[model samples]
Target chain A: MIRLQNVSKIYKPNTGALSNVSLHIKAGEFVSIVGQSGSGKTTFAKLLFAEERPTKGEVIIGDWDISRIRQSEIPILRRQIGIVFQDYKLLPRKTVEENVAFALEVAGAGPSRIKKIVPQVLKIVGLSDKLGRYPRQLSGGEQQRVSIARSLVHTPKILVADEPTGNLDTIHSMEIIELLKRINEYGTTVVLVSHDRDIVNALKKRVITLHDGEIASDIERGKYMI
Target chain B: MSFFLSALRIIRFAFQNFFRNFWLSVITMSVFVLTLITVNALIFINVLGSATVQSVQEKVEVSIYFEPDTSDDIVKSAQGYLLGLSQVRNVTFVSAEDALVAFKEHHQNDAVILDSLEEIDGNPFGSALVISAWSPDDFTFILEAIETPEYQRYIKKKDFTDYEAVISKIQNLSDRIRIGGLVLAGFFILIAILIIFNTIRVATYVHRDEIGIMKLVGANDWFVRGPFLLEAIMYSAASTAIMVGIVFLSMRWLEPWVSTYFGGIDFSAQQFFLDNALLIFGSQFLVLSVLGLFTTMFAIRRYLRV
Candidate 1:
C-alpha cells in the first residue's frame, strides 16, 4: 500500500516539482505514472522510496509515515522498496554477480545466503550466465537487467521504476515492461514512472497523468492521454 | 555471523578498490611514504643530533692548574671540594711529578717539545685537578662554586674558556637543527594532508556513480563508507611498512659512513632506531592512519548522501 496526501515539493527560488498531490494505491497493483518532462512524475516515484522528501505533506508506505524520514532509517525504507533508474546505475567495476550481491552485502547478509540468492535473482533477470562480466561488458539492456536483479535481492514489497526504459530501444523497453508486469503478478506492487507514451498505453493498466506539478487524472485501464 | 560477513565484505571491497584503482592508490601511497620519510628523517636527525651533542659534552672537561709553590694539601683539598658538588661528575687529581711524566710522554715524538719539557728543573709542572660535569651547562656553575678565596689564591689557571665556546656553539647548532627539522616536518605534513585530501576527493569522484548506486540499492552510510575508510587505513599501513623498510635498510647501510664522518663519536643512529623501533614506527603508523581516515571521511561525505 502507498499513499501521498497533499504532497508538495518546491525547490528554492519558487520552483515547484510537485504540488498538492494526493494519491493512493492498494497492494499488488500495477500503476503507470506518465507526464511530460518536469511534470512531477519522477518526483512522485522518488517520494515512494524516500529519495526526495515532500516540502509539505505526508507520504505513507504501508503503515509507516515517512514525510521526514531520518537519514539512518532511509536505508531500511529503501531495502523494502525496489528502485530502478534510467541510468541502470550499475557499478562499472563490479561484475554482474557482485553487483547484485552488493545489495545483500549492504544489508549484512551472510556469505552463504548472498551466494545462494545472487544467482537466483540473476536468473530471474536472465543474467545468470554473465556473472563474471562487468557492467561495461554488457549491453544497455543487460546492464538494466542487472540493476533490476539487484533491486529484487531484497524481495521488496513495492517496485518503483523511474524511466527504466529511457535509455533502451523498443525491444529492450518492452522486455523491461514485461519483467515489471511479471514482478507485479508475483504479488508485488509496481509503480512505473515514464514519459514514454507507447509503454504506458501498451500497459493498459491504471494510469495517473500529471501536468504542471498536479495530477490531471487517475483512470483504471487508462491509456496515455497527456 | 552477519556482522563478520559484513566486515569481511568491507575488507574485500577495500582491497578491490585499492587494486582497481592501482595507479591512484600508488600515487596516494607514494605521497604517504614521502610524508613518513620526512617524519622519520626528522626523528633520525633529532636522535643523531642529541647523541652527537652528548658525545661532545662527554669529552669536554676543565683542568684547574695550581701555582707551582701551592701545597699538596691545598690541591687535594680543592679536588675533594670539587668532587663533593652534585654538578661535578668526577675529579682526577694529578700531582706535579705525574703531570711532568704525562707531558713528556705526550710530546716525546717531538724533540723540541721533549727538550723544552726536560729543560724545566725539578718537575716545574704544577699539580692540577681535572673536573667533568654531568652536563656541559653545569661546568660554569661548578667552576663558580669552586672559586672560593682560599682555592682562588692557589689557582694558577682555569682552562674552561675554549671548551665553553665549543659547548655553546654545539648547543646553538643543536637548537637550530631541532627547530628547522620541526618546521620542515610541519610543512611536509601540510603537503601530505593536501595531497591525501585531493587523492581521496578524486577517488570519490571516480566512484561517485558507484556510491549513488550503492545507496540506492539500500546500502547504509557505514556500508558505503566502510570500504573507503578501510582503504585509507590500508594505504597508511602499506606506506608505513615501506617506509620502515627504507629507514632500516638505509640506516644500516649508512651506519659505518656516519660513524667515520663524526670522527668515531660514540653514537649509533641504527642502534637508536633498533632500540625504539616500536615507539617510532608505531606512532608513525597511528598518525598516518588517523590522517588518512580523517581525509577520507571528509572527502566522501558529500557523495554518501545519495
Candidate 2:
C-alpha cells in the first residue's frame, strides 16, 4: 500500500539524508526500518507522512502522490496516516481523554462520535484506566500509550512509528512492541523505524536496513544486522 | 450535527485551556479589559466635547444695541430688515426697562449693587435686539452685516468684542477636540495591539509543546488556531459587556445631578443616553472584536510555530 520510486532527500549540498531509495510495503504488513543514527530511516518516515517532501522522486501512500502535496492539504493527508514519535507529544494541560479527543476534534468529529470513539481507542492502547490522568501523572509508557491512542482516533490505514519505544525501558519497550503487533493484526499496515538491534531481531518481520543514505538490505523475515 | 458539535468541542477546549492557566488568563483578560475601558472613555470624552461645543453654539446670542437718538419706529423697521436675513434664526426686542429688570434679576444676590443701580430715576441703558444665529460661523457673518453703514443708521455701536472672542475660542476648542480625538484613538489602539500581541505570544510560548504535538498528530492549522481565536473573542466580548454596564449605570446614577448643575443646558441625561446608545455599544463591539481577532491571528502567524 506504499511505494517510493527513486526517493531522495538532501538537506543541503553535503548532507545527503536519503539517496535514490526505492521500497514498497504491501497492505497489513508490519515492516521495521532499521538503521543507525543519520541513516535516513527517520527521513523516510517523515516522507511517508508528508512532513518533508522527497527531493528527487515520488513518495506514494495509498494512491496519493504526497511528494507534491500542497501545504494546505497536509492535514488531510496526515489524517490517513497515524504517526508515533519517541517522546509522547501529549498536551500536558489536557487530561488523557482530552489528548485523545483532540485528534477527532481537529477532524471535526461529532461530540457523540468522539465520546464513543475516544474511550474505545484508549482501551485499545490499554490506557482505559488512566483516562482522567494528565501526561505528567502517568508513566512514560502510559504517556506513549496516550499518543498511540491519539493516532488511532482516525483508524488510519497506515501506522508509522518512529522509535516509539526509544524513551522506554526494556520491559516497556517489549510491551509497546506487543501493542503495535496487535494493532497490525487488526488489518492496518505498520511501519516502524528503529535503531534497536535486539528489538528488530526479536520480531523477525520484513526488515529494511539503511547505510549511508542507501538501503543496505531488504529481508522477508529479516534479522537486525549492523 | 457534527459541525456544531465540533465548534462546541473547540469552545470547550478553549474554555478549559483558559481556566487551566487561570492566573495567566486573568492577567491577560484584565489587561484587555483595562485597555478597552480607557479606549471607550477616550471616545466618550471626544463625543462629550463635541456635544458641549454644539450646546454652546446653540446658546450663543449676539446683541445689537440701538443709538440713543434712534426712534422705536426705526428700530422696529431695522428689526424687520434683520429678521429677513438668512443667518438670523431668532430676534427678541428688549426695551431698556426690560433689559434693566433682567440684569437686576441676574444680580439679585448683590442687594448693595442693586440698591446703587436703583438710584437712577430713568433707565440709562439703550434697548437692544438679541439676535441668535444658527451656528457660530453665522454669528460672525450676521454681526458683520449688522455693523454696515446702511444698517448703522438705525443701530448704534454694537460691542461684540467679548462675544466674538468667545465664539472664536469655541471654534478653536472644537477643532482641537477633533485632532485630540484622532491622536488619542491612534495612541491607545497602538498600545492595545502591543499588549494583545505580547500576551498572545506568551500564550503560544507556554503552549509550545502542545502546538508541536498537535501539529504532529495531524491537527490542521485551523484546528490549532481555533481555540486561541475563540479565547480572544471571549475576552473582548466579556470586557465590552462589563464596560458598557458600568457606563450605563454611571450615567443613570449621575443623571439628576448633572442636570442640576446646568439648569438652562436643557440636555436631559435620558436624551443623551438614547441618542448615543447604539453608537457607543456598536463602536465598542467593533473595536474590541477586531482588536481581539486580528491580534490573535497576527500572533499565531508570527510567534506560533510547530
Which run of 10 residues does model 1 chain A get worst, by summed lDDT? A103-112
Off by over 4 Å in 1: B69-80, B105-119, B148-153
Could you give candidate 2's per-residue lDDT for residues A1-226 as a string of tens digits?
Answer: 9999999899866689999999899999999999989999999999998878888999989888989988778878887889999988788899999889888877777778899999999989888988889899999999988988898999988999999999999999998999899999998899999999889889979999999889999998899888
The DockQ value obtained for model 2 is 0.59
Error of 1 at A132 (Å): 2.0
Going through the candidates in order, their DockQ values are 0.74, 0.59
Give Cα distance to truth, residue B117, candidate 1, Å: 4.4
